[model samples]
Target: MGGFGPLETAGPVLVWTVVLTFVFLECALIIGLFLPGDSMLITAGVVLASQVSGEVHVWALSVGTMIAAIAGNQVGYVIGQRTGHHLVARKNGKYINTRNLTRVAELLHRHGFMAVLVARWIPWVRTLCPAVAGAAGMDHRKYTIASSIGAIIWAPVLLLIGYYAGSFLENVSWLMPAVIGTLIVGLVLGTIVGVRQYRAEMARPAEDFDLDEAEQEPVADSPWRRA
Candidate 1:
């Protein structure tokens, strides 16, 4: 058995680096809108389970990914909090359309903390929701709690799926290609769905969303609202 030659040669260091970097960036930056962090996580899980690159502990990988995801969300939240205020104050700009911002605020307000948790499972939303929460003045403490919960659930679940798949295929080496092909198909379909959803959301009229001043008020006891 030759094993997974590419993964074997890449080694643990490279695997860890790639997974952590993609995970962090996918949560923290706008670039994450296009990055397939979930796929990477699943791939990492497969690599570890297959034992192609020495003994890579599943727990260690999960923990590292969880930390990176949580921290990345924090960074994105801060960026949104700071930039959102300025965008609102300015009223108009090429990138900061007040109408869109208002809609985002309304969405965040209506969903509250639940959005943070749900968004984690979503692709583009996972990267954008933290910033949206911050922009909407969601209590920071609540955001943190929700994001933490989401990250905890999201990271391990995807990793485990990949790990299990790899483990099952370890002995059936010939099936590796089929399994990978299936994953690719799934990813493509998922991306198409996510993009369509995003576009639909963006196309909705801003007037459809409305919020009262009281609802927008920042909570003093929690970092839930600051806008």
Candidate 2:
């Protein structure tokens, strides 16, 4: 049965470092949208379970990865809070465009907490959701709570699955390769779609996304006016 290649040869220290780093980066940075963080995690577990003396402590790995993921989400949230205003003010900035930002704002308004929690399973969205939540003025405390819960669930499930199921997977040599191939295809497609969306969004008028002003227009006269 094949394993994680050189990662299997590497000691537990290197394995832990690599897996944790990718997990954090995937949760914190936009570049993580393309990184194989999820796959790396499960593969780490699979390699450890292969009984080749990987010696990695499962508890440490799970807890550390969970903390890393939560920390990463916080970092992303802060980044969004810091830069979201600038992005909104500008029409066609370099990285994030206003059109997409508008859509995220609407989404957060609709499903702030649930979106954050569920985003953990959604790869690219997992990387972007924290930032969008912050940018949309979602409650910081609520975002933290939701993201923490998501981390608790997301960080361990796949890794544990791979660890426990490694024996069954060992007999199915084609599965790992197929999963890897599918992830590669997804990365390419996501990159392509993101680029195309950014370009199209940049072409739209920024003023159209002034959602705050539109909402502030008062649905009805104030109570004081009734007198």
lDDT scores of the candidates, listed in order: 0.68, 0.66
**Model number with the top lDDT:** 1
Assess candidate 1 and give its TM-score to the true structure. Answer: 0.72
- How would you encode candidate 2's per-residue C-alpha lDDT over 1-227 as one tens digit per residue? 45555544665677588778878888887667656777677766766665455335655788889999999999988977765433342357433455555555555566667767888997857876777666545678888998999999997887787676665666777775555445445645655665566556456565433435312222222111110
Among all windows of 10 consecutive residues in model 1, the one with the lowest summed lDDT is 87-96
Q: Whole-model lDDT, candidate 1?
A: 0.68
Off by over 4 Å in 1: 52-56, 86-104, 177-227
- Candidate 1, residue 183: CA error in Å? 6.0
Q: Could you report the Cα RMSD, in angstroms, for every candidate shown?
A: 6.0, 6.8
lDDT of 2 at 72: 95
RMSD of candidate 1 to true structure, Å: 6.0
